[model samples]
Target chain A: MNTALCMLAAANPVGHVTDKPINGQWYVSNVTVMLVLSGIATLWLLIPAAKRITTGKSGSIDDLRTRGVLANMVESVCLYLRDEVFRPVLGDETDRYVPVLWSFFWFILISNLLGLVPILDITAALGLNDFHGTPVGIGGTATQSIWVTGTLAVIAFVFINGTAIIKDPIGFLKHLTAGAPVFMWPIMVPVELIGMIVKPVALALRLFANMTGGHIIVATLLGFVVSLSTALGGVSGHGLAIVPLIGTIVIYFLEIMVAFIQAYIFTFLTCLFLGQLVVHAHDDHEHDESHGGEHAAAH
Target chain B: MQAMRFHLALVYTALLAGPAAAAEGANPFVGTIYQAIAAAVVFVTVMVVLKKAAWGKILQGLQDRENRIKHDLDQAEASAKQAEKTLAEYQKLLANAQEEARSMMESCRADAKKVSAELKDQAQTEIDQARQRATEEIQWAKENAVNEVHAQAAELATNVAGKILRRQINAQDQQQFVNEALAELGKGLN
Candidate 1:
């Protein structure tokens, strides 16, 4: 790997740790394919679910009353995310951002889950790891890549601050001083600024690190099983391998749970950040209204 | 404090996760710009596609369902109110009907009572008239019968007197004889 080069492919366990050429194009790699696949999976899953949700043009009572399991399950999760997870924070702005938030939720969730499928290993085992003398992969967790998560974080950051700044530019700038006196700008501004930058950076790192760490843990346990088998190289070795295999199984379960959790965490944090910024518009409006009421009362 | 801990854990994991890249002498914190761009591209594409395809329709459905339910509830409430009003009106009408029936029955009863009393009086008058007529007829007949008997007796007495004497009697004599005979008969009855 060129240590300094920034490319579309990143390292993984079973496939190319570096971007490889395929049909003379170096951009194609496992995470790329997985991202595309995740994108497709997201669309494939949600399109039908969307149909089930939409009912019809008239949206009749009986149609509204019933739904398929897929629609119901998808709807329950979406509702939870929309109403319960972020509604308090996002307030009136929840709808405006729900599409983006849901996209992130389902896409990231699917990507994270795809990583656990061992498709990369299966391809590598089937000797499809190298195709036409170029390395490629069929599956891996797209969200595990820092580029992917950081990009998502960057998008969230943009939306959060951009909307705030757009809606209330002066307030957005004023918030940089951490609500302290003008004299405190020397300290509070920088501190608040740092806090702002750190938030999204933390979101990206949290997801990337969690995903990377879980896979690593599972791999390490499996590595132990491999070493155990290799050291004895027989039935005894296979007998010795059971311990790490069990550990791998346990870690794999945890990884599965973590995949969902990390996706939820990313979405939840995005909403919280959005709420933190956008909800101020409502507060400002309320403040103005209160002031107006007070002036009227005085009159 | 919780956010700080979350960031700390992330930092700790990043350190733990980056050994292979570290050995490759790459900064793990930084990602490739191209991949970063790809990530943004892919995510934005998803957001756009989903926004177009699913989110709008799904949210609209939810809203429509809510509105439908609200409308159904309102319609149901209005219908219930109307039913209640109709029931109350029917009950009121029924009460009026029953009152009218009761009043009519009372009127009929009173009229029947009046007619019965009138019939009783008329029947009594007719019965009294018939009894009076019957009593007058019976008295007249009895008077006639008595007259007949007196006349016959007078004639017979007159004849007998004449026969005893073996002589003819005149009208004036006969009258005297009839009066004597009647007086003798009256004395004998006493």
Candidate 2:
């Protein structure tokens, strides 16, 4: 029963030894390792695709052709993100931000997918849970950790607010007051301010919660099989374990879908939030104002 | 103002940390600021590397393909227009040839009619000249025959008178007979 509880606790961020500080101000957690691995994995796949794309002569027939299925698949995803996802929201500025968004997408996706594998359980079974009393096994989803998601959200927050301010300082300041009259500034300012902070907090929590929650459910379901077996104290309990095992299998498939969904949601929402910050040209605003006036006059 | 906002955010984060830590027994809600810094570093590094390495290339390839497609379409349109123009020119040339052929055929028909009329007039003139020549020749032949016959007749008459005189006939009688005969001959010649 204690072992089952311990395994269930492993689903929590606090249960991992890497979350603790190894030295002063330096901590090496499972998430840190996963981040590095995700980065390496990203490089491994994309570098070859890049080579395939770049090595071809421009304007050649081969340039029009994709290198292979993997390369083509990667390119298709990139094109879809740029054209369908990013362009509609970011407009002309889509190109400038694609690299960052793509990096985030690939990183989060790989991290989520890697978490689905039972590497940590295998390592634990092998008695390699700690390396010389330091938690250094291959396991845990980086995106599941609040710190990782918080970091990503912070970065997005900075990009959104920073770009908004840089693009139009006066407009940004004005936007904060929600375009309200002088009388409403007091109420609107705090609301806008809170809204600004909330965007990043929401981004962080959404990813962290989805990932952590799915993992907790999966671990808990599997723990039921162990607890049932222990309760029966014989082959009878082992036979009953099939029920929870089936349930765990179903949840496992759900977790896979959840992983992809959460990554997409995070990226899509970031694009939406970033899109909001981009200021249209002044001419458009004047056109809108005139149109609004005409509409009011007609009314 | 920015610094004050930053401090306020930090205080807010600290205030939230206590409850978050107490809730999950290990506080999954509040992460160390260092983790956020590490993530930032990792993400930035990944972004920079990817931008330099792969993303730029892929985008360039896509752009190149787009431009190529545009250029090919433009060329195809131009060629189609050229073909249409060529077809129009050929059609015009064909129309001109047909018109010229029609005019040429009409002119040839008119020339044939004129030539046939000229040939008929020439044949009629030759026939008339041949008839006139035939008539002149018949008149000459008749004159010759008549002269010969008159000469023969005069000679025969003189001879007859001489015989009669020789037999003792009167000279005045012979002379009257000759004169009558000569007068009859002259009427016949007329």
Candidate 3:
């Protein structure tokens, strides 16, 4: 068999086929399909949901407030991400960046959820890998790919830094000084620069590591069932297979939770990083004063 | 045979993965730059498209609804306060009307009592006057009857005297006889 053919021939119980070099060229992969699919899925769910969440042309607030579960869930998550997550850090500037942050959340979350769906595995089961003697791998976890996650981090980094520069160029420059004394500027600035680069790198690694680790674990456990049952070859083979099967099931459910959590962590950290740039010291002071008054009143 | 075939394939796949994954680098974390570029394009497209499609409308709606709810609560509170004030005013008016009616009733009763007392005094005076007049008329009628009887007795005595004498006596003697007869009638009336 050809090396390129072997790349696509490998099934899910074996490994991720996208990891191989089919033709070893810069071409679209399963990750690309997942990217496009996740985008479409996000749009499909939200486009209609947005209409329900929006106040009707009748100008009735009840229309917005009294919506169905999908609308309510979307609205609540958006609100929690904005008011609880973004507003605390971004302050009044929260609204300006809510679109980007919300996009990050929904896109990443949907992508994460899509990864849990075994599209490629199902395709392999259907024996659709060969297309007229050509091997085509059509599914994989997009976020599990380092390139995909790196791309997301770079986008986040650009938005975070771009807003910082545009919003307050002076403060953004001062941030490079790392709030150290004049004499310490040389060392602190370089350190700050590296830290800035490291922030997005960490984001990329975190998402990639989380998705890759969990999905690979589930696949490996399920692969054990296949390997063990075939190797053992009898009632004991099937009976021993139950252990890895149960393990796969358990990890599969855990992957679902990890999917949501990783999405939240990625978006939250991005928001926090953006806040560090866009929001200022004075803004924090003002926020503290206002919230302090609110806390006192509440008590 | 099947078991051997399956395990052999796993080994086969593992062998195949090593070389291809190492094509870029010995490091597994090494990325394909072009893949990143493609992903960047896709993510940007998704984010930009969704920002327009959904985020703007949802945020604006929440803000507008909050403002409207605050406005509605204020209007409701104002309306409730106005109703309370109007109710108090009406209650005061009602109390004043009740007081006025009670005072009027009291005054009417007082005036009736005063008129009734005055009428009773006037009737009493009229009855006293009628009784006095009746007593005076009875006394005057008794005196008139006594005077008539005295004149009749005197006239009888004069005629009797004239018969006994069968002639004309001295005028002084006749008159003396009649005077004696009037004195005797007055004594008898007393």
Candidate 4:
């Protein structure tokens, strides 16, 4: 039980890196490796698709046809994210922000999926889990780490506030003041300011918690199998171990779903937040008024 | 001042609450600044590379494809409109030709009827004239034949009288006899 708990602990952000120091204050971490791998994986899938799309003859029938299956699939996902998800919210500004959003989504999704693969176990079975007491295997999910998710949230925070300020500085300040009556300014201003910080913090915590929680559940359930086997003697213990093993498998599948859901949620919320900042309060109000008036007239 | 105090209070509360607990031997909230920096660097690098290498190109391609499709559809619509116009013109022309043919047939029928009526009238007049002329000639011929018959009878009577008397007849007596014989023949013929 303790060993299983230690293994689960190893999945967390602080301890997931190798203890072996490469330099004075620098140490190579499993998450760093995963981050690098995810980046490379993203490039591998997208670069070819991009080349196929750009370099092909523009008006030919073959050019209009979807490139290979992989390229087509990638294009479809990108188009859906841009047209359906981001464009409706961001409007004409979708083009300006889509590159960053696309990178963030694919990077995070790949990182989460990497954690689902048992690369560390495979390396361990091959007797290559560690190199001279330094862990050198591919395992940890970078998004499960608070630091990784926190960085992403911070980047989102920068874009959200920066865009708001850049678009209309005075409006942004007024936004922080919450558009309240003069008497309620004292109360509303601080609340809105705190909300700014809280939004990204919540974003970071949500992703980290979701990814870590699913992993912990799977680890704990698997630990039960070993516990049950050890608790009972020999043959009966081995027979009873099958129960938790089945439970662990079920949770593992659930983790996979959670992985995709978390990635989508993170990207979706980020787009929504960015959209809020990009379009001003006055603009939103006008849009609402017009839309409401039209609806009433239609009715 | 009130807003500042509220801000401070919120921060204090957040710090006190801290973060959720982690599994044994791990602190969930405790992340190294180094790792955060590393992650930031990685994210920025990925964003930059992908923006330059893939996203821009992909978007351009999609835009191009949209423009091409729109162009093709516009051309198709234009040609369809042209085809529809041409069909309408052809239908109109065909209708005109059919009307002309119908009118021409009516005129031809009228001409044929007029020619047939004129021919019948001319033929009737000729036949009437021929019949009148033929009757006139026949009457003339009958008169001549009657006169010839009277003359021959008169000569024969004169000849018989002379023969009985065994003497030649005089000129004045012969003429008076012929006149009387011709007048009797004319009455008989009428």
Model 4 stretches with alpha carbons more than 4 Å out: A1-27, A56-67, A128-138, A177-191, A220-258, A280-282, A285-299, B1-23, B26-30, B98-190
Tell me how each candidate scores on DockQ against the true complex.
0.15, 0.16, 0.18, 0.18
Candidate 3 lDDT over A1-299, as tens digits, reads 36424432332432552343334454555676788898889898887888888887665546657378998899889989888988887888888899888998888889899988888768657765443455555676778888889889999999999989988899999888856799999998998798788878888888988888787677666655765565455786688679879988999889999898888888988887787777776455554464344334223
- Listed for every candidate in order, the interface RMSD values in angstroms are 10.0, 12.9, 5.2, 12.1
Query: Could you give candidate 1's per-residue lDDT for residues B66-150 as a string of tens digits?
Result: 7887998999999999999999999999999999999999999999999999999999999999999889988988777765666
Candidates ranked by DockQ: 3, 4, 2, 1
Q: For this target, which candidate reaches the highest DockQ against the unseen true structure? A: 3
Whose DockQ is higher: candidate 3's or candidate 4's?
A: 3
* Per-residue lDDT of candidate 4, residues A1-299 (tens digit): 46534433433333332222222233466566667777788788888888777536544577666668887887888888888988877888888988888888888888888888866556645655344554344556778888889999999899889988988888788876655788998997898788778778877888888887776666555555545554453666577668768988998889888887777767777777777667663464754553344234223
TM-score of each: 0.65, 0.66, 0.67, 0.69
lDDT of each: 0.73, 0.72, 0.75, 0.72
Over 4 Å off, model 3: A1-14, A17-25, A65-67, A130-132, A282-299, B1-31, B73-190
Clash pairs, model 1 backbone:
none
Stretches of candidate 2 exceeding 4 Å from the true structure: A1-26, A129-137, A233-236, A281-299, B1-27, B77-190
* Tens digits of per-residue lDDT for model 3, B1-190: 7666456545643544345333433233544776688688878887777778888888887777766878889999999999999999999999999999999989998988888888888877877787778778877777777666655666676767678767776778767876787788777756
- lDDT at B138 for candidate 2? 86
TM-score for chain B of all predictions: 0.64, 0.53, 0.53, 0.66
Between candidates 1 and 3, name the one with more favorable DockQ. 3
The DockQ assigned to candidate 4 is: 0.18
Error of 1 at A225 (Å): 1.4
Clashing pairs in 3: none
**Candidate 4, clashing residue pairs?**
none
